[model samples]
Target: MPLDPGTPAEAPTRTAELKVRGLTKSFGRAAPVFAGISFEVPHGASVALVGANGTGKSTLLRCCLGLIPADSGEVELLGQQTGALGQGARRRLRARTGMVAQSHNLVPRLSVLSNVQHGLLGSGAGPRYWSHALAPRRAREAAMAALEEVGMADLALRRADGLSGGQSQRVAIARALVHAPRFLIADEPTASLDPAAGEEVMALFFRLVRSEGVTVVFTSHNISHALGYGDRVLGLAGGRLAIDADAAALSERDLGALYG
Candidate 1:
């Protein structure tokens, strides 16, 4: 199947928080994972990526972040081209972005506060950071503020391993938020939690979008969550961007066909 290179009918200007033009990736002897995909996410906009399993949703996001290099095209984030930047420059760019994976990547032995404090590592401290890695008063205060945002301040002293799936996800969000990132990329952030738990996490995530004005892009398997929580929904299928529409304008039935 040929992947469509269609963009949204109406979108923000080039001043968007993220912009992709002809983005593509492939492995040897295999078809392209995604091809010529293009889009823009304006500052403070929330975007949801939805597709069936194995549709290249995860790979596309990784490519956008430059964790996995794309075969062609460009991804500009915060006015920096991810593919063309040097490592140090890319690190600096990433400092302005945050990430959350499906599995809470918290260090089990670390306290919740410590795990959240670890988020400060992206801020470009010097080598002395490793020698005295523990959170300083200022860092701890920032981490606490992030925790308070997620309603997890009361459990700051608890070990990460002791928290439930929902709590751990909240802590992970706090870790992402500690830097006050201008953008956040999340891959299946609430996948492991139960429905109620997922709702709580989604609520908190949306609140961050509305209140903090953080531009967000997250992948979702559930159509409702994608449409309900995001300002725009982009659907991937057959290695193409099959749908790009306002979340409010799309229906569950409209998205259901894409999954099939």
Candidate 2:
């Protein structure tokens, strides 16, 4: 069972990139999505979250990001107790975190550079997203730098609608990097791409994380990718933290048991 967040005891020192203790959540008349789950992601670490559908992996990510409240326990991220903060603080915190979702979510008519600039919207220091066409030269240069990192600089002037699934995902990554966030959360980022493209994107994702020292927490359906790319593997099973171990210690057979 999940521990109460209001008890005299509070979550301990917030040293990890992300941490959750005794966290839980549920909708009415349904089993709890998370029941007393707990885990920690260290700074500059890459963690792969694996679980069956509807197991709350995405929900946990949301709670960790302070986008949604956990019904009990607590979530701490980058030194802030997420649910304890006011809405403004949460928004600001989210602004500092980069997020890449399953859908590329790029504006079809926008050029790759324009789409990348959208990442700056949450930076809180830039021109509004709608007026990015007239954004300061500094913003453009920053967007280009991010694009260059993702190997999408050559496509900067190309329309997003014209790019393939893999290209779009890379551009999406570029967009996420435009914020220069220290932490990044990605959900099924390669689900829509072909195997070759998926491999390319994942290779790029881990390469960037390794080179830039960014903390990453991502979800994946592929057990092999999870084991190969992450230093830690977290298997969310039956509404609990079923498996939390070093990726090297967990084999594909071990991870497959979580799905079963």
Candidate 3:
């Protein structure tokens, strides 16, 4: 089904944090994952990408962040045209962004503090940023602050593997926030957790992001989350953008069509 590519009425006046125009991607010998997809996310707006499984939500996020090259079209992030950046510049641009995924992506043997400190590695890599003991006092303090925001500071010294699923996600959120990214991208961030834990993590995550005024684009299979947490919702289906509408204007019934 074809859907309008328009944004919220106020979106056009605000500076766009992200803009995708006619973005397309495909793997060798396969149909396009999504073709001619387009949208704009106003600065500080929260967007939810939702679709049924295999709809390429994760791949689209990767393309938007320039983690993977697009087959065609434009992706502008932070007002910079991604296709125009060289490798070094692209890396530098990506440093200003944070990412969270379904998997916690923590180092099992590392202390929670150390894992959070690694978030600083994006700005620059060095021994001092890799371990809690090696990190400078300032970095350590910042990591703790991030952990405090997520209610994970008490587990600073615990090993990553020692935490429960919910605790691990809290630490993951801290790691993502430690660098104070201007934009955050999360792919199914709470998909692995039980409902109660997912609810807590989502609440904490959005509270922290809102307080910091960070723009967010996260994918989720949960329709309730898509509508409740996002300012706008984008839906992908049948190798195209099937829905783009204000989250407030949509109901679960409206979104259910995308699943078919």
Candidate 4:
């Protein structure tokens, strides 16, 4: 039986939630965005991927999620090698994960509740599950519970396009969490918000994910957020992983080199 959306399933027993080895990606004939990047994120850890713009943090995150194929490398997610997974296998693997982006990515005309319910689409749910009006009572309850966790349930009936930057992000986070994912990937989650909003959102995001024991991999340009929220920080520079250290062992000064 499927677990309740409000109840995260027991995380699979895995040594590492993610492992990347010799990962490389590049456009046709151009220099590689990054090369030979390797790392391992143990289950339940939050990792911050940081670098100057164009350092391929987003590409690396996508590769890790199997959203994009790497040029030449191995990526293991949840104990399965992504490259070796066939389409059906990959889809099943991805169903166990969730993602958020800077753009919010909400369907503008949709209600916030509907947007969050969309998270269940990965479950191969039927069209009735796609809209709040037609969604099963259980699906609506689950989505509402997710929004409540993000402090956005009160706005459930509002159109997503009508929300503020911060509110939209909360809705996005709710959508990501609605399916009770064991692994969460976020790219520049706070990039679109103002400083104060960004800080608050980051705090809430980590708190909820941590409470649920979700393993998180996120990218951030905000050094403070990276250091404050990450258990480990990784900096990419010059097509390589230039910094990989426990967040407690590093500070802003340690990450400045990636930007220089």
- Per lDDT, the best of the predicted structures is 4
Where does the lowest 10-residue lDDT sum fall in candidate 3? 2-11
Instruction: Give the per-residue Cα lDDT of candidate 2 at 150.
Output: 86
Candidate 2 residues lying further than 4 Å off, grouped into runs, are: 1-14, 126-132
Residue-level lDDT of model 2, residues 1-260, one tens digit each, is: 67687766665653488888999899887889989998889888889999999999899888888877888998888889987798778778888798889899989987888888888888675555534477788888998898899888998888889999999999999888877788899999899999999999999988886788889999999998999998999999888888999999989999999888
Cα lDDT tens digits, model 3, 16-50, are 99999999899997999889999999989999999
Backbone collisions counted per model? 0, 0, 0, 0
- Cα lDDT computed for each candidate against the true fold: 0.88, 0.87, 0.92, 0.94
Question: Global lDDT for candidate 3?
Answer: 0.92
- What are the per-residue Cα lDDT tens digits for candidate 1 across 108-164? 987898888878888875433322145467887888889999999999988889999
Is 1 or 4 the stronger prediction by lDDT? 4
Which has the better lDDT: candidate 1, or candidate 3? 3
**Best by TM-score, which number?**
3
lDDT of 2: 0.87
